[model samples]
Target chain A: MAGYPQNPSGYNYGAPPPSQQYYSAPYGVAPPPYGQHQQLPYTHVASPYGAPSPSPSYGAPSSSPFAALLPSTFPPGTDPNVIACFQMADLDGSGAIDDNELQRSLSAYNQSFSIRTVRLLMYLFTNTNTRKIGPKEFTQVFYSLQNWRGNFEKFDRDRSGRIDASELREALLSLGFSVSPFVLDLLVLKFDKTGGMNKAIEYDHFIECCLIVKGLTEKFKEKDTTYSGYATFSYEAFMLTVLPLLIA
Target chain B: MAGYPQNPSGYNYGAPPPSQQYYSAPYGVAPPPYGQHQQLPYTHVASPYGAPSPSPSYGAPSSSPFAALLPSTFPPGTDPNVIACFQMADLDGSGAIDDNELQRSLSAYNQSFSIRTVRLLMYLFTNTNTRKIGPKEFTQVFYSLQNWRGNFEKFDRDRSGRIDASELREALLSLGFSVSPFVLDLLVLKFDKTGGMNKAIEYDHFIECCLIVKGLTEKFKEKDTTYSGYATFSYEAFMLTVLPLLIA
Candidate 1:
């Protein structure tokens, strides 16, 4: 918990305070680094960012990192987006998603997500989808996980729960990250990884990847930022990085 | 073992005795029961009254009473026939089949099978498709189960692994069967629901449904036919009677 950034509102670590509301902006504009991002005009969506989110009043109220990342037109609970993902997950549409389905969804989204990873997740959520889910519907897994953990103890491999340079490396590798020399070095020194190969951070590795990516998100927020009992996060970055972790 | 019809040759139930290889006269004009009464060509399939079978093989090694009632083409492992079923069951063409699949296949073949019945059968063979089932596969789940005391003791509610009149009735009702008196009486008297619902019998019910009513493959064979120990079968009657039990 000490590594967590401070958030007065007590929402997700590194996340913005609850007061900030994103007005709908255009989507697909410059898009992200991937393929061409769609450009959505305010006319296409309902009040853009003003659209209702899936979660209730946000409880104590905290803006989403993903919603914060995309333009306002991209509302939090976009029906069409969810529908497509569900279709991918429920190939036969038998009212529930199964292991093969989750695998298909993962492959559809990121070729990197292996069948093993999807299978593990499926076992974790087997028979739970009495209600149908699309590949996108799986987002709940990641979002809930990150928002829920709030600290590194659970995922940290070395048991120290703190991300050191080498520990972060192994953890990232397990999660399907490509470690470049400079990127590894940056993450290493900053992440406090140097513990050893046998030791590694678990979920913290994933969180580290998402939150502190810099211009992308708040990289190194855990270390550089003071411990406010919560990790600091940017809306835009969390959505792209952390949120995608849950998708099949 | 009293019920286990002695499979002397061990040719799945009473498949042709691999050794003796008795020969028989081919067919002349068979009766209207197997032919004029069905969707497919009537040939080697054994008729209820021992109508002259088309195949040179006499008796056609019928497994159950209901078997006598099916079209000849639906014998064990028929190519085009099973291929159609596979298409239906393997919804995604990923090579494996699951529950809802067998359900649709049975329903399409006859009026007897229902969704609940299909689910029970699918669940019985839950893991078989993954492993290449052969000699060991033969007795492991099937014959071996006849002696199974553990599973029967487990799912058995009132210390009776076997469901009796009241238990079967309740089981059917729970599975979603209305338990019509005519069917209820018929079930109590014949289907031996009185015995414990051990995994073997469960497998038996599934195999019987697929081989008899649904016009699917007939790989499941009786141990033997003679008093020595062979399973009696009914390939003709629709399995809707069992659907209630499955739902329950």
Candidate 2:
């Protein structure tokens, strides 16, 4: 409750008008507010390397950065839409994508995630044994990306397409995380593209930061079974548990 | 503080007498109270399968369950005493021990850890990629086992060679884990070998149970960075995070 939005109505920044009957429809099948397959103006930075790029053309032929790297066909049972999204990311056509490919894919979506973020994503969703992010893992990652995008828009109340430190805190709070000021500063420092001038997080970095925090927190919870704030660990256990997430 | 021992003086159940200055000495080099290698009376069960066994002979030629399995020599810089201990556990001389070997080794120390506990140990200290527990990993584990053994002895207030539910609660509390009644009961049910009649945890089982709790808690703390007692995780992240520790 402490992290809940203070004004519920004010929180619905991007909610469709009550007249839009399909606003509440299931994801992946809902029609866009704009015309189907209509490309929006790419206002956001499309690459972490400071490049302007074309927006993604959903429900259309693949024109992603990695389009040339996609396989001709996807594995059985992969949803057609999901296969389309996966192809945009699976840059090597191995039916899997690594961190570099994922970065390019996100850039194609006009979301500029850092290499570190994509590595963390690979660490989280890829097969641990093979370090591969196949179509199934891609689907989950895409869904989370969209979910985080929605939350980001909702929290970016000014429609500036970015959230400053305070807005970021509110966003995390709404997501059930009440971080300390120290941790908040750390998050902002880690994700803020403004070089500490504005302490702001862009749409892509917000998703990256949130996923990192969530993944790390979930890993920690596995050890804190009694919900005790304190936990004991051998030196090796401590290193093994933390180093992978930070260094992966 | 809720978990702190009620009577501080009473908590030192197995402390050496005041005349014994080396009681506070560093581990691995200190002489045992009985003798440098005196075999203590084998009072506790040595095997999970109810097999009575000979006590381990320290500071002497190896006659352990896995003595025939030890390598002729150890890796360089391995502490002589530590090597002695490792040899006792490194059954099959692969220079590395798996969960089964670890279980046998703990049993040699008169500590009958369950295969599950040893598996968790491997999961925690072994090389994550190789899943192998080598000498270095074994050293850390051995140290932790000794530490836990000390704590277990301190909390076994009745000196009945086992701690009941109340004593276990005190043990965990002193170790900074104030588990809820439900968690405490669950722990007792899982670790208590008396089939839930007396709800007592033996020395070895206590060590195993405590390690499991500690490892899991440490892992959870990674994700709960905000310390909000809550975390958000994607479905795959949740499964990947929790499943290995539970099933490994």
Give one digit per residue, the lDDT tens place, for model 2 in B19-46: 3121221212232234422221110111
Off by over 4 Å in 2: A1-79, A127-131, B1-248
* Among all candidates shown, the one with the greatest DockQ: 2
**Among these predicted structures, which one has the highest TM-score?**
2
Lowest-sum lDDT 10-residue window in model 2 chain B: B42-51
Estimate, for each residue in A112-190, the C-alpha lDDT of model 1 and write its tens digit: 3434345334423322212233333354443333332443443455465465534443333332222333344434433
Cα TM-score of candidate 2: 0.37
| Top-lDDT candidate index | 2
Give the chain B TM-score for each candidate.
Answer: 0.26, 0.65
Q: How does the DockQ of candidate 1 come out? A: 0.01
What is the overall TM-score of model 1 with all chains considered together? 0.21
Candidate 2 C-alpha error for residue A176, in Å: 3.6
The total number of steric clashes, by the backbone 3 Å criterion, in model 2 comes to 20
